[model samples]
Target: MTIKNQYGIVKIAIASGKGGTGKTTLATNLAAYLSGKQKIILADLDVEEPNSGLFIRVERKHEEIMYKMIPGWEEDKCTFCGLCQEVCNFNAVLNMGKLILVYPELCHSCYACSELCPEGALPMKKQRMGVLKHFSNGKINFIESKLDIGQEQAVPLIAQTLDYVDKHSENESLVILDSPPGTSCPVIEATKEADKILLVTEPTPFGLHDLKLAVETMEKLDKEFVVVLNRYGVGNAGVEEYCKENDIRIIAMIPDDRQVAELYARGKLVYKKSSAFREALDRIAEYILEN
Candidate 1:
């Protein structure tokens, strides 16, 4: 099948500038709303702290151990030259007189140490970072990445998960991806071939500022996108005015409600409980379809 037809199923990515902006909340509810209405894949690309599973409660169907490259010290070939430490940008290795100490948490798996180790004292080893979990809730496919606590880079995990989705979704489905916070590499990887990018932001100054950065990033990627005003009453009205002035479409607006907060605290998808939010989510789905 052609990629255009494969992708014509509609891929929507919901992302934000920073964390705690209700990005996942919006993504999850939207996925829930589109659950039976269409063939949908709900992907949570927040590898570091993916919380979509907590709300969706889907039965995990497939999981794989995620791995990354780390330095393996070879004691026999050790020159104790300390060049590895010098070239190591993450400070993961420290050589102290006949002993090589490795702080795994400090390593970025950049392979600079092994490359610069003249004595070949360092080798690359695969280390488990986390798991790529796949689940199914009714007709919706749920995918999530949970990075190991100390593992810093989530880009690889996100890339691998997206690859999994692309490979596994051969049947064609409306893929709605929940991207990680910040317009960083992980977010970029998640939203990479997306048909529509939804920037979810609040009304606060930080929200507006970060949204602008995210919007700029999407514009550079040359992807079709729109904005979703989340937590509509947190701060100034500048985001709305900015969207209007910039000719950016406001696809949906979710008002800040204590009940929503309560549902979130209880780890639940709002569409499961609140009819209003469900209706709003349906409208968001309709907007996505119309656009």
Candidate 2:
């Protein structure tokens, strides 16, 4: 199926401009709320630091290693020609007359050089970047990805996970994707095809600044977007002011409570059936269901 299809399901992305903005907190709660109401897939696309699993206990299903295809050289088939170098746009392939160099770090793994090699000297190779973890929390399908340390690119892993979700979701279940904190490539990758994005933020200056960055990204992406303010009274009112000035909707505001932090530290969720966070989240969730 095409990535654009969205499998006739609402794909909601919970993201943030900076870390420590309660991104995963909101995501986990939203996923839990939706899972009980209907079928759902909760995917943590923050490959570098996947912490959603810490909040929700799940049985680990079988996982598989995720690989990326890079280019390799077969020295025996080399003709010393410059076709490989000419076709490579990433500057990953280098031809120095007698010696040819392949820089894996600079490679985009586009395979242009390998495909155009006149002598068929270059072949594609796989590099283990990370693993795709499959999990199940009763009715909810949980997907959390972990990037191997020092891996430069996480967009590929995020793409692979999205593709896997599209292929695996045979029913019209909501896909709640928990994205990395930031407006970087990884965040963009996670929210690129999302049906709706909830930008989580606090009430401080940094929160407003980073939310602006995330808003800029959403404007460029041109997707349906909203904002969720977490820990409302802990910081200044900068976030609310910014949203009001920009005409952006504040979908929900979760009050700052010490009990929430204590529960989070103990690996417990704060958004329960009677909690204010869950009530606000349920209202925001209705947008997906009603739309």
Candidate 3:
């Protein structure tokens, strides 16, 4: 299934409109389906709250602290000029009468303040954002990041997660990214370099509504993507209708089954119990190869 130009590596991002929409389920299953036959790595980029490993259970191979650069002020230079605060576009730097404050949460690490400082009063300092873990069950490698609880910004941590994947990505293999929900900056960062994205949504009004928003986000990124209608039987007809009207292809429709839900709740995968899901995932692999 390797294309001549493709290094046999496929980067597929599975994202949803909002949380609790089964993005990780589809991502892990897809990676599980490709195990043994192809080199596959599953990355959980939902740094704020990651749970992909609760099911796969790979032995943790490595872990690292992910950090971002924040400005550090030098009071010894003797100046309360507030130049750093004035240059910061994110409002991360604030100056008081004699105290210079650098809010790490609001900083984007652009280094603009340090670059523009006259006396080099500001130097970039590292702040811990999260921890990244690496593991492998022989065939599928897993990497996930967990943002420090109460951490407000996730983009820096998400970058570290992807950086690990990019640095450790297996040659001639596939990378399946489980992105955080919503059309925010973190989600955008996850989907940036993906060759194709699988947008998973249900058949309800909320599903359709957020699906559209996600679709717009993908279009803005100019990346090719397809839709996955999960729990197809329970929701309304809007999912299919919207796909038809928008010329979007429906790659797979997973039925709402008590068995699957129960297995998921127990941290079990469907392929361990049902052959149908395995077959469906094989079909999805073929769809990715074809398109």
Number of the top lDDT candidate: 3
Pairs clashing within candidate 1 = none
> Per lDDT, what order, best first?
3, 2, 1
lDDT-superior candidate, 1 or 2: 2
How large an RMSD does model 2 have? Answer: 3.5
Per-residue lDDT for 201-270 in model 2, tens only? Answer: 9899989999999999999989789999888888898888888999999988888888877777887877
Better of 1 and 3 by TM-score: 3
How does model 3 score by TM-score?
Answer: 0.94
The digit string of per-residue lDDT tens for model 3 on 1-291 reads 542125656788999988877888888878876776877889999888899998887788998888888878888873878788899898889989698888888888899988788878888888888889999978889999998876789888887788889888767778889999999899999999888899999999999999999999999999899998887799799989999999999988887778888888988877667766776677678777875
Candidate 3 ranges with C-alpha deviation above 4 Å: 1-5
- For candidate 1, write residues 29-130 as lDDT tens digits: 877776666667888998888888888877879989988788888899998989888888878899997988877667877888988888878888888888
Lowest summed lDDT over 10 consecutive residues: which window, candidate 2? 1-10
Best by TM-score: 3
Task: Predict model 3's lDDT versus the native.
Answer: 0.85
lDDT of each: 0.82, 0.84, 0.85
| Candidate 1 Cα errors over 4 Å, as ranges | 1-9, 233-236, 272-275
Cα-based TM-score, every candidate: 0.86, 0.90, 0.94
